[model samples]
Target: MKSAELNYPTQQQELLAIVHALAAFRMYYLDEPPIVETDHKSLEGLFTQKMANRRLARWYDILAEYQPTFPICPERRTASLMH
Candidate 1:
């Protein structure tokens, strides 16, 4: 279950990736909370944001169904590890 979406804001793209991953693997990890690791640290505050934006609100609603723990993955560290 791999995917890519074009022409979205950086935040939206990050959220989309989480949505896709959860949808793809929901059956295996539905009962257990999923650990979502990413370089996007701002995502840690996603649910706390004011949902004035409809798109973000909808995305938040979609995400509320699962228990997700976001672990910060520093971009520099990830890039270095990939080398």
Candidate 2:
């Protein structure tokens, strides 16, 4: 497997990028479903919840574009890896 690094100015943008990155990673690397590791657990809930903001709505639309079927798992022990 390969990994990529991304930088964002805001937490919200970073979260959206993470969802995009994980979907890309799964499409490029795994044949079976892949589990994404994220530092923010709130994003897991946010992705499933209805969007209230325009930016969030746009981000959600980008996330939905991937048709991602994999699950997202919050980092259990090493949270600094992504940062």
Candidate 3:
């Protein structure tokens, strides 16, 4: 994590991981909105709820391009992988 990123809240850090992964392989996911599996309990609300953080705003802007879906997978099923 970058020095500045260390200051981000846990939720933002989790979202950052998603954004970074998506940006890294955008081409393969462009045709279809990728399904991200995680146990992040608020994954659903993360995209729907409003937030005031600038980092989240920027990350959402980047994520908007893919419109990624974050599924609430069971802990055993969620290995931080895309399905």
Report clashes for each candidate as comma-separated counts: 0, 0, 0
lDDT score for residue 8 of model 1? 71
Q: Give the TM-score of candidate 3.
A: 0.79
Off by over 4 Å in 3: 78-83
How do the residues 21-50 of candidate 2 rate in per-residue lDDT, one tens digit apiece?
766675564454444555655665666777
What TM-score quantifies how close candidate 1 is to the native fold? 0.79
Q: Tens digits of per-residue lDDT for model 1 on 1-83? A: 23445677677788987888888888978679888888877776776778858878877777778877788888999899889
Per-model TM-score, in order, reads 0.79, 0.51, 0.79
After superposition, candidate 1 runs with Cα above 4 Å error: 1-5
Q: Which stretches of candidate 2 lie over 4 Å from their true place?
A: 1-11, 19-34, 69-76, 80-83
- In candidate 2, the residue pairs with backbone N, CA or C atoms under 3 Å apart (3 or more residues apart, or in different chains) clash, namely none
Cα RMSD, each candidate: 3.0, 6.3, 3.6
> Over the stretch 1-83, how does candidate 3's per-residue lDDT look in tens digits?
79998887777778888899998999899789998777888666777878777767888898888987776878756554545
